[model samples]
Structure formats: structure tokens, C-alpha cells
Target: MRGKATVLLVSFALFVGGVLALQLERGGVRTTLLVLVFAALGAVAVRQTIRKRKK
Candidate 1:
């Protein structure tokens, strides 16, 4: 529960940051970090969903 909440919050922050970063430019480290952040969030979400179904 706590872990999910933390991931959700962090992902939200990262998304917001990513949007801001996008406003700055089109491609760079910020954009890459944003993509990585989204990928991380997706992985966490899928992992949690799988864990829940296993139980």
C-alpha cells in the first residue's frame, strides 16, 4: 500500500516535471529521464497488478 502510494506520487511528480521539461525543449536528458520515469511507473504498476492477482 505504502509502496504503491509512493510510486504513484513520484510518478505524478515525474510526469509534471516531464511536461515542464518538454516545454523547455524537444529532446535531451530531461526527455530521456521522463521516458524512463514513465517506463518505471508502467513496470511497477504491472508488477503490482500481477502480485495482486496471484493472491
Candidate 2:
């Protein structure tokens, strides 16, 4: 389960990096929203991973 979570986190990071690379020119509201959404997802993943570790 931990390994799966790690893979998920890495995949999310890569996806966000790809999005950022594509939006490198004209960043606007959509890019900002995407970043925020991804950040929230990352936070959730981190929280869950920590919770599992404490178990």
C-alpha cells in the first residue's frame, strides 16, 4: 500500500510537471486553478501516507 501510494504521488507530480511545461508561455486563471487543484491532491496524498505510517 505504501509503495502504491508512492507511485501515485510520483505520477501526480509528473502529470503536474507536464501541465506546467505546456503552460509555460501564457499562464492565466486556468493554470492557476490547475496548480491549486494539484496542490490539494498532493496534500491529501501526503496526509494519507502519513496516517498509514502512524498505524
Please tell me which predicted candidate would have the highest lDDT against the true structure: 1
Q: Would you list the clashing residue pairs of candidate 1?
A: none
**Candidate 1, backbone clash total:** 0
Cα distance off (Å), candidate 2, residue 34 = 0.0
Q: How many residue pairs clash in each candidate?
A: 0, 0
- Give me the candidate number with maximum TM-score: 1
Against the reference, the lDDT scores of all candidates come to 0.78, 0.72
TM-score of each: 0.58, 0.52
Per-residue lDDT of model 2, residues 1-55, tens digit only: 8867786887677677657656666567657766776776787678768978999
- Per-residue accuracy of model 1 over 1-55 as CA lDDT, tens digit each: 8977887788788778767767766668867877876887788778878988998
- Candidate 2: deviation at residue 51, Å? 0.3
Q: List where candidate 2 sits over 4 angstroms from the true fold.
A: 1-27
What is candidate 2's CA lDDT for residue 34? 69
